[model samples]
Target: MNSSLFAVIMMLAVLIPSGMQAQAPATYYNSAYGKSGKALKTELHEIIKSGYVTKSYDFLYTIYEESDTRPDGKLWDMYSTCTWTHGQKKCGNYSTVCDCYNREHSIPQSWFNERSPMVSDAHHIYPTDGRVNGQRGNDPFGECANGTTLTNGLGRSGSSTFPGYSGRVFEPVDEYKGDFARTYFYFVTRYEDLMSTFSTSSTSFSGNAYPSLNSWSIALFLKWHRQDPVSEKEIVRNNAVYKHQKNRNAFIDHPILAEHIWGTLQGSAWDVTGVETPAELLARVNYNANERSMMVAADLGELSYEVVNISGVRLLSGTLLGGDAVSMGSLKPGVYFFRANADTLKAVKKFIVQ
Candidate 1:
């Protein structure tokens, strides 16, 4: 974003307060506007699924060096308090928690038949203590009452403490609950198209695109997402993952996006501002094939927008007002995103055209 566009954006939408700050460029969230509930979830699904780079399961070890490294160069294993050097200890075999580290599928591979993209996706695969990973044993994440504590004494595995289910469950420490919750959110949304085909044996997922989580899991994850909040560790990891994976954890980038689909913001338009809206005002782009032009329209009062390709390369940018149709007829045929923002159209550097 240039200085002039930033000035236009600030004048269009009200700035959201601290908790739900919007982070991406003006064009990143354009197609998701005026959508809520399932529609919002679908928009998010499309956004996160774009440009995904599929690495082999073995490559997760490489990903952790950047995504989960602690300041002292130790693996940030949430499953145990044990300290570990990045590549020094592989999970050869472990009788104790600190003996070795391995890839722990936060969403266990069995539930999805150990398939391709899902199996290799680094977003849900975490480097964890082998012993604690064994303790989890494919249980759903939840509060456990009188649960068996791990060797490090932070995580627990036991019968349910939460309502609606009494099955065995695993619970991590409070500090990382939000991180795990948001990871689950990204997993379900990104794979939503295939969700209906996934096995629902775990009882956490309903296997549906919208409200994909089971009743109990929905309550549990929402509670976790609200309590833990996004942290600096998550922000750093999000960037690192996108650098390799080509997509983002939208829930981490815009925590309020979760509310629009599953919590408080339901039934409301998905706006970057998160302001209360009285009606369903729509904004969209339609390419006029006859004239070889891109047509953008919005009822968002005065606005600022940028046309960018999937790689974040800017093609065109300017301001628009009212319900008028603005055309870019000279533009060639190609897929482009029409992003709208208030005054926060800062530097969109991920993709820059020379």
Candidate 2:
């Protein structure tokens, strides 16, 4: 589906929700702000001091696996087309975790010098297949794919185009055009400032420098964004990745959230309410009266958060006192929202009962 239509679908899903907002949960805030390199290091130290699990490489691996979730043994998995089972042939037919697929950077890293940052930046890294990556080549994504006459060596055609420069361009499969579109949005947001230092065979951004990306690439991505909207799976993965990375992508975060944060941070606009955030940041419930609430406590332990009642209301919110027994039997319970916050980090959870 096109970006617009995909957005509409997401909107409808959000509107028809069982009480969750159409927007992202409060956890996105935790994923973005309130951390510096030194602060992160300090926080990691504190976690270690508290005997929390803190592995440097494990963090990256956790995010990678959560983002990819490939049961088929594909290094990175993509959404299934036919069924909902992970790696199932023609999957994505079910609403389960199977719909999300592993996408790739259309501009392969190997084309560049395989520099330290670009190669390692997980923001641009994708879960596309090795076969497709080889087919994409170093071509800039562009309009040549519109024509039928062109042919790529891999039986694909029309991927090459006038990149507004001497080099070539490539096109993505129709299904993933939107994925690349958002990925490009993410790429620009993550590295637009350093782009001038980036080595390119052609000067794609020499002129018409408003949003500042290769015109061919930008145009194609914009078209894809407008045509094939983001999927629920993509949005979920984007947030999950953000949770792991502690940075927000312009394309991945809800467009509004990105706009508000970017405008305020970039000084492009004066957003007064930027300081105001969801109540989840303050406190939440960590235990329940009825069941053991194993998963509920697990979220709190991992995220260091608290819980609240439904309706965005707060209940018991604080740091984990680490007592095995947490009292909750006194409160009336239909549904509840448990949350936790550490500076800019926040996590929300839902629970239900009799």
Candidate 3:
């Protein structure tokens, strides 16, 4: 079908669930004028034009905070201050702000011949580094080659050891991998037409030989969606960007947004039998979390859970029980996992310190 119709169908699919065809909760209002595809396309152009006056490469550096030698001041350095100025040392492995980053293009501008709206799109561009961007290259993302050796773990860059798929892929550090994966998902879905012209042998592309995403790319994206899932940071940034730019993407709207899109459009669900939350039988087993002694519970039917930090290291897991409180008194004063699982439902709740 057409892009507009396709988006509508997908949205509908997301609102309604499978196995049971109950009406969707009226929580989300379609703000896209009932025209998601073309309207978004037009909106993208407008957003770019509006930001044309204020956007500068320098602004990018500021957003992530890289060291600046330029008289104009450094964007990266400023961003670093925002993210990690509290500690003298960088929160990440890098020793300095400059060492830690580059102004990364979330959507490689090359796909649209480096067009304006797509080129400097703030929604997709991020402050990454050269090494990580190089490893990521233009290849579509997927499971790395079995022997893929890591070049820069901090940048999340690596070469796949998998035959046929052995290519450079910028694997994101655990913290933002899910966000990056979701960005790619949003990009392709947004620009389905432009996707065909781009290369697609690696995990970076859709892997579909037809200039569109092949099944492999789709499957890989689905996997990435799970492994390096969304974070609170992304949500905060997403809202900030939307407010600042007056443009928003569905992927940035919610973690489960993709599930809705894919389910509605493709009628498929993300598989997670081996990858989902842990068993509920482990409940009542004390686990340390977030420097606070807390209780954990699970609802087997819902796959919902909570995580209380007993120590710094987060004891995170999924698919346990929901509403079933587990004790945290015996555990140490650090991060802990109080996972809850009930079928396909899943969440990672973070608790604070005393």
Candidate 4:
């Protein structure tokens, strides 16, 4: 064989096996294609349920050491910025903020009465400062306004400041907001059937697979999911957990799936079509905000568009021809979301109407 041909064959041999391995696990989601709402959520639950390996609470320490460590090789404590030595703070009682970290149930165990799988689920458990973990104490996540009780740079526990709920709650820093939102999304979907048996006093979780979160909490989490987006840390942790638990969080794999299941973007657009990357969908259309109009690329073919306010109220809806502009001249000066939809395409862009 020619040297060049042999080199090409060698490269292919090395790449083929790794590529196949990467694609194998995701094949579990094949049945979920073109599904949305309750159907999508239930399909995911069943697909992921098969691989879940329940670990004891004690096992989490070993897992966190591998999964939650910061790049600097220190324990990654979400509740505080304190640096912790590895394994120094495993489940120890603390009266104040210490140098050690402990297992924190982002979803408190008491909420489910310490049920087996839910109690030990690493998807919702994090390693955080022991003192701050105590302060959080099963509180539902929310923004704090007044009556501050604990402030640890990275998290806070206090009276609720967020609208729609006025109970005490714990709020993590902005950096991890999307991370927690995805985790919550995973919790509701993966354990949708088990939610009815858990406490709902401080939770927004409902028993149903669709609309699993109550209105207020859903709105808050959706906003957070968009604002923070997904980060590399989340992607890395998600892959690590999949290795241990044998299931993947579909929301992390496809962030838009959350919208299909519970948010405003649901319908046949997402139901009949598979998920698309934001860039792939956005590349199909272009918006000229100065003229308050959008132009669909010819390759995208004909499409429909809607202009909605930040609150998701539809202000205008119309069809757009390929290569032609759809005017938004009648829209009032404000912020709005430009949503484009086609048979197999869905994209949303935020624009200011000034």
Best by TM-score: 1
Could you tell me which 10 consecutive residues in candidate 1 have the lowest summed lDDT?
345-354
Q: Extract clashing residue pairs from model 4.
A: none
* Residue 124 Cα positional deviation in candidate 2, in Å, after optimal superposition: 1.7
How do all the candidates rank in terms of lDDT, highest first?
1, 4, 3, 2
State the displacement of the C-alpha of residue 162, model 2, in Å, after optimal TM-score superposition.
Answer: 7.4
Q: Where does candidate 1 clash, by residue pair? A: 1-348, 9-342, 9-343, 10-342, 10-343, 27-339
Per-residue error at 348 for model 2, in Å? 23
Once model 1 is optimally superposed onto the true structure by TM-score, how far is the C-alpha of residue 6 displaced, in angstroms? 40
Q: List runs of model 3 lying over 4 Å from the truth.
A: 1-56, 62-100, 145-152, 155-164, 196-212, 263-265, 268-303, 306-325, 330-345, 350-354
Q: List per-candidate RMSD values in Å.
A: 15.4, 14.8, 13.3, 11.3
- Over all chains combined, what TM-score does candidate 3 have? 0.57
For residues 176-238, what per-residue lDDT tens digits would candidate 3 score against the true structure?
556666677556654555565665433356533222445544555666666544433344444
lDDT of 1 at 344: 25
Candidate 4 total steric clashes? 0
Could you give candidate 2's per-residue lDDT for residues 189-211 as a string of tens digits? 45444555555554234222124
TM-score of candidate 4 versus the correct structure, residues matched by position: 0.70
- Global Cα lDDT for candidate 1: 0.72
**lDDT of candidate 1 over 330-351, digit per residue (tens):** 4554434455543322111111
